[model samples]
Target: MTDMNNPDNGGHGEWPQQQRPQYPRQPQYPQQPQAPQGYPQHAQYPPRQPGQQQPPYGYPVDDAAATTVLPPVPAFDDADATTLLPPVPPLGDAETTALLPPVVPGAVPGAPPAAPRHRQPVQPPFQQPAQQPVQPVGHPQGYPQAPLPEGQPEGRPRARARHAAPAPQPAEVFDPPTMTLKRPPAPGPAGPVGAPPVPPFAAVPAQPAPPAPPAAPRGRTGSPIIEPGLQPALITAGAAALLAGGAALGQVALALVVALLQLLTAAGWFRLNGMWPARQGILLAALAGFTADAAVLLADSDGGVAAVVGTLGGFFLLVLVLQTFRPSDPKERFYALTVLGSATVVTALCTTLLVADWVPAGVGAVALATVLAAAPLPGPKQLGPVLGLVAAVALGLLVGAPVALGALAGLGALVGRRVAAYDWPSRFVHMTAGVALPLAVAAPLIWMATDLLA
Candidate 1:
């Protein structure tokens, strides 16, 4: 092969330029001949003459124009040019110029000029009349008058009065009469001098002492040891325990119970946070709980915990995204996120019982704790929680659950009871959230305990 890289090679030489192809020009056609000269021609107008006028071509010649005569055009001259325009009036002082009306151009030569505008005489500013002084009407004759204050005029009195004080009067002295005491003889069963004789002293009748003031009705010294709504709370706790115990029957039945519990939790949480009428937030939290439950159920036994965690994380992100679309103030949005996040977490916690095998033991401990705490035992306020924990441990022993699990569940129950009592919870809150929250709160503890002990 020839050296392809060499500039001297024939392949590297410049190639000839290609010429552009041309086509033949179009053929020309012959022009037609002009019309014959014999055709009739249009009539021509005559040329205009100096100092002469003519009507325009195509203008009709009426009898008026033909019969009437027009004056001949004047010859151009300096004198005649000066007379063409009217004379201009000389400028005057500003006052006269302003008073005169403007001269309008193109007015009739002899027509009267517009009447001149005259200046109106100015009037002086208004002056208020001097006010006359009012005379005093009720002056007593020879009465001394108060001296006028400086700057006040002689005839005019001050707007305010300063009255002269009245003269002092003479005082009179008073004398009292004197009295003398007379001596009486030594005491005999008789009256003193100039008095009637007295009778012997008689025994006085005894009078009953006033009945003692009705004893002040005693009021309660302190708050009750057990908070109000304990009975309803106890009943609610019992119901939650019964539902949790249903796990032995079937997972579906237990799941249905848990779902109901989560629904109540969502609703109660919104109301507790004063966010009622927030139907969307309630439904979203409930859905998150249901999803977590379903995920726990569908997942393998060992993957149950992982399934719940994943579902919770996904719904958390969903809550964040949904919050962005809410048409609320920034503060309201933040508050909603706080309420919604807490509600979702609380609802999701219910899934722990479903995954854990010791659901009955834990729920039983919680119920027992609530029952003992609600009982009106005679003791200090702290006695309730102590007794509740004791009962829980004993119940756990009987049920063969760990003592730690029992104590934890009982503690959770006490805490949930306190929450129910907080902010003066109503009977409705006690029945719903109060009933379910103990078991819900203890579920995770139970799960962890069971896992550790196993």
Candidate 2:
């Protein structure tokens, strides 16, 4: 008997090659006889008893008087195996989201799938590949590199490079989250690219020193004591003196003009004293008339110049002595003594010479020139003095003074001009200079020349 559980029939697992299926499609055996209960399902046909005869291997079996009609088997051929498989059925409608069934391997289970089939890597439900975290993209140098997350493959060089360095951020100045870019140096040879240079500092120029302050007022350290309308009152007195003296004195109105000039001098001094009380003494001018009359008398005598010089020195010394003894506070005694004393002496000398006809018929020229010298004309300040000198020269020549003498006298105003420009104790510090200098210097020379000519 042949046993199914023994796999080969009659103890043979496979038939010899010539005795195997002769066609391309191997025929499936008819349903095998199943053993009873749990004996075995697949089994070969039961053994024949006694001396039964075996059928030949290639012969076909047919049973006479069979009830069922069977489909005829096609004759076997030995060409390509295309006709071996059953025809494929038409595809039916299916949902798009449905997952396709995995293709089961036939004989060779260990081999890779064929080209037309998919072969996904099998992994356990618990061990699914870890999803990578997203990273920001940036320049390679901009950000620092960190270790990659777990489970990522080593092949992603580009991803690693991108993740290693994040994008650059804008720098802030006032906030100072990062250092701001240094400012570019000024355009110069001192600085070069990549290396910054120190900048040069400019020197601020020094301002000029301020001018000295004007003279301070004096007299009890209180308000200035000038009377209201003093200038007008003095001018009216002077005009009256002129009219009265003109009638009383004889010849060419000498007393009238002298009185008027003296009154003018007093008024000028009074105004100046009020302007700067600390520096001038109006009292000295009251004594001027007395000295002036005596000087005129001495000039008519032989030794007049010595007498004049002595009188002037004595008056100057007396002023200094008075300053030492009286001791007035808030008063600039040095300035008062020097300016007042010099001015009074100079005024006396000028008046005496004017009254005494010392210049030999040149009074009109001298007087006009002196007035012009002090006049406030426009253009250069020097223009006033220069025009005055030229006028003196021309007028003196016309008035019978010699050209040499007139020219010498005209140059005298140059000294006066220098004094006029000085910053003096008072505005009238130049009173002596502007009024007395030209006449005092020129008159003496004119007198000598006239005497020599005579």
lDDT for 440 in candidate 2 is: 43
Stretches of model 1 off by over 4 angstroms after superposition:
1-228
Clashing pairs in 1: none
Per-candidate TM equals 0.50, 0.36
| Residue lDDT tens for model 1, 52-121 | 4344344677665454454457688765666655543222232233444333222333469856545444
- Minimum summed lDDT over a 10-residue window in model 2 is located at 89-98
Worst 10 residues of 1 by lDDT: 173-182
Q: Report the lDDT tens digits of candidate 2 across residue range 1-454.
A: 3443543243333556567544344588786565789674542345654344434455565463132244457776633443565433222122111234222212233457645424445433232243343343332452334444687743332332222322222221221222222232322333343344332435557789999898787545443322212233233233333433443554236533543445444444434444345333555653664465466554655555555566667777777787777666536666566566655654555444433332444444554455565566788857866786788678767776666555555565345334433433243534423343444445445544444443
- Taking all chains together, the TM-score of candidate 2 against the true structure is 0.36
